[model samples]
Target: MSPQPQAAVGAPLSRVDGRLKVTGQAHYAADHAPEGVVHAVIVDSGVGRGRITGIDTRAALAQPGVLTVISHLNAPKLPYLDNPGGYFNPQGQKLRAFQDDQVHFRGQPVAVVVATTLEVAQHAANLVKVDYDTQQGSTDMTDAPSFELMNYARGDAEAALSSAPVHSDRSYTAARTHHNAMELHAAVAQWNGNQLTIWDKTQWVLGAVAELATVFGITPESVRVLSPFVGGAFGNSLRVWPHTVIAALAAKMTNRPVKLVLTRKQLYTNVGYRPRYEHRVRLGSDRRGRLTAMAHELKAETSRYETYAEAILDLGQMLYATPNVSQSYQSVALDVNTPTPMRGPGYSSAAYAVESALDELAHELGIDPIELRLRNEPQEDPAHNLPFSTRRLRDALRTGAREFGWHRRNPKPRSTRDGDWLIGTGMAVGCYPTHRQPAQARVRLDADGTALVQSATSDMGPGTYTSMTQVAADALGLTMRQVTFQLGDSAMPPAPPQGGSITMASVGSAVQAGCDTLRQQAIKLAVDDERSPLYGADPDKVVVRAGRLSVQGDPGRGETYRRLLTRNKRTNLEVLGGWSPPSGADRFSMYAYSAIFAEVAVDARLGLVRVRRMLGVYDTGRIISPKLADSQALGGMVGGIGMALLEHGEFDNRDGRLVNANLADYLVPVNADIPEIRAIYIDGEDREADPLGVKGLGEVVLVGVAPAIANAVFHATGRRVRDLPITAEALL
Candidate 1:
């Protein structure tokens, strides 16, 4: 059959659920309240590492409206079955709440207080006291022992670095940061015999269902998870935290529905956060700015009980062309919570070190930064030994340079000034691999000329609801108003976990396939009907528009789907379709690309750095929704600014406690701090990547932002600060 008309695919449309969200009608996880609901408050350990000795719950039990105060000493022992679907922890076991008396880290949940009222729960939680036998522990990654996580080598990098004409070596450090989204993590769980239902703040409903079932030693089919709306997650909500399991356990023990919400301060300890990292980059280049050899050594913090690692060495191996390259990544186990993927994951951290080192190399060779990057563009992926599906770094660089007026930049640092402010401009390139997994979606078209598409995926503020609707409308030959998309329920068709920028490629493709199948089924029925206007027409030449089936280039020969279905006594048409990526090695290396540019002004006397303007040019393939893409790009740039000059997770190593645990002490960019920002997309699509031709967009937008701002800071001031959140003291 002929391709569906591309009417709504690239349209700049508003969010479909905008009215509900603006009017406060949309309910988040914390907003849910099941019947007979009771409140639960978790009491955490004060010591970093120790064993519980004694508990005093008499005062808490005497309080009015208090249901019970249960700790490891009084709580029933759970099965604690092995969870194969749990979050990625390659080395150690995940944390199990109330399973034992051993305390692994500070802020570990020790006991819980359940009460008829939330106020009573809070007061009773403080009344219950626990004593522990404290032991010394290390929380600082710089002082902890390191274990080798991964290593890679292509050639003799040491020999090549020794003989190179010019060399650059530098060390860069990034402070740990938290997601701190507007919504707090919450869960409301209810149990009926063996069946369990939970409303929780999570990125993956099916993953949570699987995890909860394993922890309680129940069948997966007995669990149902629902999370219809999420304020924002970034990456913290991808896993099932200990508190979620605690809520379920509490409901089972109390025989009443339980509601648990993490306070703002509790968020710092309960959920996962990005870990602090230290990187050493060594580069060897020729006088002409071509790279000869490169080596990277990295160390990051992780919980002593669970190992956490990311693709921190990917950029060093693939971003540039080098004959010899070597990399080693290590995790320094600390007395802290396990780190999780935040925002851009590994690429964002890697960019700061790799791009900053490249800028230094550009200065040493007396070559333009963009020009030097252009000189070493690899013809193929050196690590994968395959051609790129669509590598548009060159196009992104040239487009950003022209739009940002790169010709006006002065090569000398601190050469341009406006009154007391020193002005400078810098640019960097970023890349993220395209990831796709198995996904299935269901589509049903009613005789009333409306459609409903559903999947088990989620929308964590990336406009998944709007984008999927667009794809479905186009595929089904219907208008935007005639289609509705539903998500964030485990009862729907199975879908991959929503993270890693894979939702669009995997879930979207499934929607497209299902809609296309149902539309064609309607057309086939019409063409076969003897009484229809489209009777005897070739099915290959049929096209649909506004619920009407017509022959190609013949508007008069058509029939409305409502009339055809009503006449045939059909209620509705339905189909279930899925999309799966091929197994084995891919034929081509696929990745999204970005070229980011930033301009900053620095006050020499006060040591204040202000971003004046920013621009990001992206080649992330087809634009499903232009307006939402801009929102993602601009938000990422703002986050990058925080990484460069505002955000930091300070730790008091004496007890492995986060000093700035609250938002009041922790800093983020506000309206007064952000400047004019813009996003541009290069025109193209990558058919080799996915059926939708979209290489994921969310993660790549944030990958190179920090390095771009950091490089601009170096140009504005003569001094180079290797650490993140460039402070006034460092500048002075």
Candidate 2:
């Protein structure tokens, strides 16, 4: 069957909330100020590990405007229920804020000061004194005391690797990375008796609501979380952090609403970050570049309290299709806040190691990198033994090559020199598995000729509002201006957390269901009403278009929805839309694919590497918004550039300190660092993934990007660096 007439989907539609954002009307978490709201400032533990021996808050309480101070000594211990389902919670108790005197990591919140103003709160917090008995804690991943290997196997990988005629073994490491969003980690909490309401910057509001309710020993319904606008999350706000709890506790203790905002320095410690990864790979291939055996080991850092994990072994198992494959994964506990998912998470880091190895193998075999990949492309998912719903990676590679003029380049390293710079071209394959979760939405069409859609989801700077509006507009045959899409309120219909690249597939399917159901209701009414012009028309053939219900073959014989609803004495027609995972989903392997191409210029004399241009060709299924898709592609590339050459966090294991915690010290890409970027998407659909035919696109755009740039750098200079931020010193 043909799809619906798409007037909004696939169109270059601008964001519906663009005006609200640019005009400063958008209110983020810190922007909310309720009646009698106070401020809360938190104090950090100076010691890495130990027990607080003493506390002195007399000076802080004596200061003017200081409301009160909270510490483990004076704070009430109602409940600290276990958070077993947190994205990265490990066995044993999760860290409880203000529950005890024991400190688990440096920068742990030891005390909080509340005051009438932010300045007074900060000053009072500084005046408060705390003394602790210090103990040394292990903060280095390489010096971990214990290890437990995870599960992954195929045919005997060790035997295959030893028997193979051509093979290479290499190691790689990625530095820890912080998610420095435009907005700081903040929360505003207000409690009216037992009911708790909070405005916090978070990626998962429902998770926050659940955690807060469990901690306070209240019903889930008693807690409400609001995060209407988020500057940027990148998975940092996916979990319920310690600071959020501090804000709520301060508010409840003082019997007034309280706001808490993390300083730039504090943002590095409490909020989660992308863990540093240590990767080792041993791969073998035939003369034609077909993979024979693949074995890899991955180790990443986590906090002593929580064990974090992501999809890191996916590529080694199935990416290139080998007869024998083995993967060992382990998490090294350290004295830091628990790590969380950051853009692309494990796949992006794994790609840097695997793609770079593939490029090296291709160079050794004198085969074009693209040609080598084509030789090993799998007919089905090698790991799951399932047919792909859609895999257009070949098409993306061909198109990207054609568009980027790949044929004009020389493959030999340092061969294409232009005086001060040696230029080269490189490409890598990208993959990110598709994910879906149950979602619900409520749609209402009023007699006033307008529609309202509500869901408990978040945007997080992804243009979710505009894209969702487009989905509803097309499904219900309504113009963009006539529809209002609302999100980020717990009062709305239930929705999955808006991360893991699942929002569009999960929430969008629900939106389509709601819109289509509401439209069908209108059609049934129009076809059955004796007073309507379309009476006696078959309901099966009736269609809604431009607010009018008409017979499929004859559009002229129809009545406007406004007239129908008014004549029936009904104010609105409402329906609840829901989506469940398809039963057949398990029969197919679903993933979004991309072919990233990059050109680089390296100065041999000064050891400087610069990206000249970049192109990302994606096989993400069924784009609902072209303009938004293009923006995502560009943004992903920019982030990849930073990952390849600039972004890295320094830590002092001796003191359990993140050395470059502030933006001024930490490096990220600026406008002057990026070059021209182009994004092209293969037009296609994946019906098996969802009703909307969308595979997750957010994570796929970032995968393979760092590797593509690194390969280009290797081609420009004969050096191969196994660590991240491919430094100038390494190039030299």
Candidate 3:
């Protein structure tokens, strides 16, 4: 049997790094101040699709403190390496910043102005001018030309749909959304001989190292990436974008350390975004609400150079017990930058469509939404025909419903009213596929009883540092103050990207393994030494607690690890622990599930929708830190509210440019927009999943929220809004 997870694994503790974060001692990429480091500002193209016709940098060079204005006209052509695995780039566009005059999208970096000061660089960048030969570009997913459709089919969906007793066909649209993290993307590049040292804001340091090495024609080992602290990522920093490469190129060209910070405007155009999606779903069910057939067709926008596809229909095939299921996903190539995965990516879009359709069907059949969902629950994954590793979705739904007082909800639209507001409640199921990756961690125990754990994974404001420290402390039998967790450096033990909610499961296991090894080593030393009280005791009978080794059933006979190390004349003991997924673990159904309930009050006269309360019950295997997990779940729900009622990236189809590029125009949920939120985790385990028994809670928490709120809005006003950002205009 696996050993128990000690200390804070299930404890409701605050973030271990909370003090450092609040005190402003955490070091972010832009916070570093290296000696002789210059500043750089990118000059972006104004035209959406164009080729440069002229360049004039005389005025930019004439400015004081200006070093050089580098553009495609003078920049050297570098090697464009082949695509490496795991970095999701559909375009396969090799790192080619400032390599050509051709522009594929608006705000594409045209040139970079370097100067002694950030102010000088900014001023010089505006002084540079360029002429463009513009061409009409399409940004609208509906208007853009599409390619061959990708299809998945199980049985005869058309026949089943036509023969079913009840059927519903609906269309839904999800608008483009930006990451909009609090910290803007920045990169600091320095070259010592042929080796490159970069302090960059990124989700995957190994991916960044490979990308930079390939771009500069250098070995991967020659590049060092550091991002010890990140304000927030939300999948924006998952890849090293062109801006990072441009900074490195600029630094190498001028032979000086350079810092480049992307402006908020540049963030929308350069970094990846959640692509807009249009889905048409047809559902067929019997009078008993058993799903008979499901057909889903999806179209989304991608860059002209890339064919990006979001698995918007993957869940429909497995979520219910539908025998006839057919899905087709297609993409329209547009003159825009390639889109990447956002939080919940395809699953969020899928949930919005499928859950909203279910709500509609429930209303049509005069059936309770929860009852309808329960009637169609599958014992196994219908698509894969495999038993689940561990599925507690029914428990989650029941618990959430009871907590939300769902039995008292009035199903009839506009039937429940309070004063001038129409009140209603709704719920939806959330699911995210569980993913695992191999990871490594190192633990060093010093003679003074202090321990340090190191990994390449990053925190990104999710309390990764704190959680790992807790895991290390518990495994090593040390206090929290005795352990320090270090991450966000490529030099540390390698780890997978911190996104996908896999960091804690992968890295925490490694920390556990490392600490266990350290403890066992100390035990072996204590039992073998003739001078120790446990000299004759069997190593297996010795247990370490509070950094002290003692024989089993004898608490009084123990020696401190510090004393043991001092007697051995050793300064410290170090161990490296590696963790990979259990063999054959992927052969079964694996996913994290959540049931979300929302209460809403819609102003009938003003056509305004306001959320009043939200409750989320999750079946994430084990709670690592109850307080941190609660925060993650609540934060995800807030983000979902924004996706449902406020957030949308408006694009000007005439030029394919994002119209609301800045914060003032683009909307996100503020503190005033959030409602009272609560989170509950089903106390459970999936021992086969991992040593930590943890499934990701981050992405799944937000998956069902938008649809739940949308369903509630319909219940409040008798309005079925299929599109996202269900605004007052939609109600009106």
* Number of the top-ranking candidate, with lDDT as the measure: 1
lDDT of 1 at 511: 97
Which residue pairs does candidate 3 place in steric collision? none
After the best TM-score superposition of candidate 2, give how far the Cα of residue 76 lies from its true spot, in angstroms. 1.3
> Candidate 3, after superposition: displacement of residue 722 in Å?
0.6
Score every model by TM-score: 0.99, 0.98, 0.98
Q: Which portions of model 2 show Cα errors greater than 4 Å?
A: 1-4, 85-91
List the lowest-lDDT window of 10 residues for candidate 2.
83-92
* Residue lDDT tens for model 2, 1-732: 123467888899999999999999999999999999999999998888889999899999999999999999988896876656545444546778889999888888999999999999999999989998989988888888546537699999999899888898989888888888899989999999999999999877788888888888999899999999999988888878889998999999999999999999998888888889988889898888888998888898888877777878887677887989989888888887788888898789889889988999999999999999988899999999999999999999999999999999788888988899988778898899898999999999999888999999998988999999999988887888989999998878989887878999999999999999898888788778999998988777776677777777787898898999999999999999999887653899899988999999999888888999999999999999989998889999999998989888887889888788888889888899999999998989999999999998887888999999999998988788789988889977
* lDDT tens digits by residue: candidate 1, 452-482: 9999999999999899999999998889999
Candidate maximizing TM-score: 1
Scored by CA lDDT, what does every candidate get? Answer: 0.91, 0.88, 0.87
Instruction: Name the runs in model 3 displaced over 4 angstroms.
Output: 1-5, 82-87, 583-585
Reference-based lDDT, residue 470, model 2: 93
State model 1's lDDT. 0.91
Off by over 4 Å in 1: 82-87
